[model samples]
Target: MESTKTAMEAFEKLEKVGEGTYGKVYRARERATGRIIALKKTKLHEDDEGVPPTTLREISILRMLSRDPHVVNNQIEMPLTKSNRLLDVKQGVNKDGKTVLYLVFEYMETDLKKFIRSFRQTGENIQPNVVKCLMYQLCKGVAFCHAHGVLHRDLKPHNLLMDKKTLILKIADLGLARAFTLPIKKYTHEILTLWYRAPEVLLGATHYSTAVDMWSVGCIFAELVTKTALFAGDSELQQLLHIFRLLGTPNEEIWPGVSKLKDWHEYPQWKPKPISTCVPNLDEDGLNLLSQMLEYEPSKRISAKKAMEHPYFDDLDKTHL
Candidate 1:
């Protein structure tokens, strides 16, 4: 398939959405059916044999899971097909000779970052009720991924998308996601965004499981309530400092083998300030949920299933009740 012609045939380019390190996303319209889609065009890297591994991983996992409404509605508009595979799956080449990979997604108006900025600029707090709703939906998407044996290693505000009108939230960017329970080695330092990374990860502990994702959800929850990054820091050390400043330093009693982490030697041993000082504005119930979600021991973190059952959401109106 020719890159130029295939792109032209499948969808008409509307406008560029955002540029990443390796790709540029564009708003597009499907020519055959006139449906809007987000075309993610990635630049081929010869180092990795032209095809980007990130794109490949996303496509591979999405292919099997795309049929589910929880995953489908989040992004990747319309069902996929061979032609939508971006290039000749066999030859791995396109007409333009430049490797082209296409991921057709339902166009989103904005991301969580933009939405958060809007609310911050207006000096309006995200209502507890609204936060609860968004949290529930996010849990649904994360649970769907977990159930499918996928783990989104990278979870951040920029990757969380939303519809402008309805304020619906969806998880985007599965480039870092991997099939869960795969036999991989320990000490994989590919640390996600510093602020949202789990304590175990920052401590240089590998062999991590789905618990890393739970930590991200906790950070996101705190962000929603505080209207600021929960552990905003300039560097990895600073991020740890921020975390300890709030959650209190992890003593061996609280987190056995705390000193066993590969990088634990770097920071000085000190107890953290009280949790209340960390989030003075948050209510007890909100803080309770956040604390569980952000447990020092990944094993102690709340699962998505239990998170939804927390009493914090008891007041939510079911079915628009």
Candidate 2:
């Protein structure tokens, strides 16, 4: 932007709120208007060539999708230069002399992760009506992304922001990173809960589709119903085991090309079991949808659009969302 206003000059930091894939997220207020917003500060390395192309692509995607109510407000970079293809958010450098990028976003009251925690702490299940509403909103948002050819890659509760009063859910950190952004980052170990990872990802598939996010949607669906993670695992191997133990071990018959995956291994075999055994609270329609989302074969997995159309969400009003 041409306005010589940097993020520091335009906003006053209120307090640190949370962290994202790349940096510290702070709750701040605009100095001129006092409107509350969240600032995601990404620290750039001294040796890096420049801003990654993926980051620019993400910025454009955010701008395009933010119009959808279920997606967060766009993370517009401050004081950007218009000439270069790389519209850097590099507002200023820190005391340590590392370059910093500030991502401006509309602040919501809380996120789904914290929301679920509060309910869990109180030993209460989220109301059935509330669960249906949230799930519909989630499916609507995911359907929007997939239609645009964007894969969230990571879709855990933490990345889903929510409003306490309205229960508005927005998908955050879309196309953020593979690793290295979070403080405790490790490839697949830390910074990510092993629970929501898709079976194909665990099997080391070289390619993926929106089916991955649907798998996570299924996991989140179960968590919302039961007030706990469906497949809480400590490690990748254990995560796959958690899935297999519940869904039954996959084979050529269940998931074709299962043995051909890069990380495939010979292991225990089992028969398929009813999904309701694990997520027993769901009604028949709900169970059917969840099972489709958790299909072992990626090809058979339900798409977000189809998920939104499922009988499980028959009573939900779609016009408002």
Candidate 3:
């Protein structure tokens, strides 16, 4: 396939974005188009270590998702500028000996965390209309991803980005995303951010599907409305209890085969609580939507498309493209 942008022409130098468990990011510009973008410079360690797997996984997945506008589009370096490519930015040895790689991306103004922090600094809480706009755009992006068979296993406010002009939310960080089709692959039980994880994930359910993402969507939507992390827990068990306390504990009648999960036998038992007890201030429509999203049974969780058609969004009359 033809490449989109070359390293030498992408940028010179700008400012740093942030550092994570893996690498650092910088804001840069495209020399050719004069457009701004983020240059994520990752360290390539000698041993197959922290930076390699996640870095390579993110690059591979971003390349796969390059064509989708709703997803962060990667600017691939071209072969014509192969020699001129900016390899000196970093150095390392691959499995086949010496090699180097660099990743370029469109510059995002700020992430959801930064955006919300900025809003809080001004003492102006996000309006419902603004929240609806952001959520709708985020769902639209995620819906497009799910439609094309990609599952963003990790969905959290931090992974969401907002552009300055329209404030349209874009789902960033594809490091944890993978394509899922029937006869799913056997993977680890550990996935998703602790607060945004689905109930099935906490129950040690391995055969998960798009429903996992739907649960995250619910958590994100609720958090946006409340302006705080919905189920902020430091542990797996705590996270489960937090969710149960809000949405009520799951029973065999509500979620069938609860006892058959890989780690079901050792879980603590608790009585379910009504939603009103946890979120007394939430309107009936909001509670109803959250209940559908946080459903213990994956089969019963609402799809991204159906969630878009929910009545909670009826008052949001503006189009956010």
Candidate maximizing lDDT: 2
As a whole number from 0 to 100, the lDDT of residue 110 in candidate 1 is 86
The CA lDDT of each predicted structure is 0.72, 0.75, 0.68
Arrange candidates, best lDDT first: 2, 1, 3
Clashing pairs in 1: 1-95, 2-95, 3-95, 77-105, 77-106, 248-272, 249-272
Give the lowest summed-lDDT range of ten residues in model 3.
78-87
Model 2, position 144: C-alpha lDDT score: 73
* Pick by TM-score: 2 or 3, better one: 2
Candidate 1, overall lDDT? 0.72
For model 3, which pairs clash? 37-107
What are the clash counts of all predictions, listed in order? 7, 1, 1
What TM-score against the true fold does each predicted structure earn?
0.86, 0.86, 0.80
lDDT of 2 by residue, 1-321 (tens): 312247688889899997756789788898888888787787767887766565667667666665443322233221111100121243666778766777687777787888999999999889988899889888877887777666677788887887777666777776543322223222332333568988877887756667778999999999999988999988889899889988999999788899998889987876777999998888999999999999999989999999989999998775455
Please identify which of the two predictions, 2 or 3, would achieve the higher lDDT against the true structure. 2
lDDT of 1 by residue, 2-34 (tens): 455656676799899888765778888888888
Candidate 1 TM-score to native: 0.86
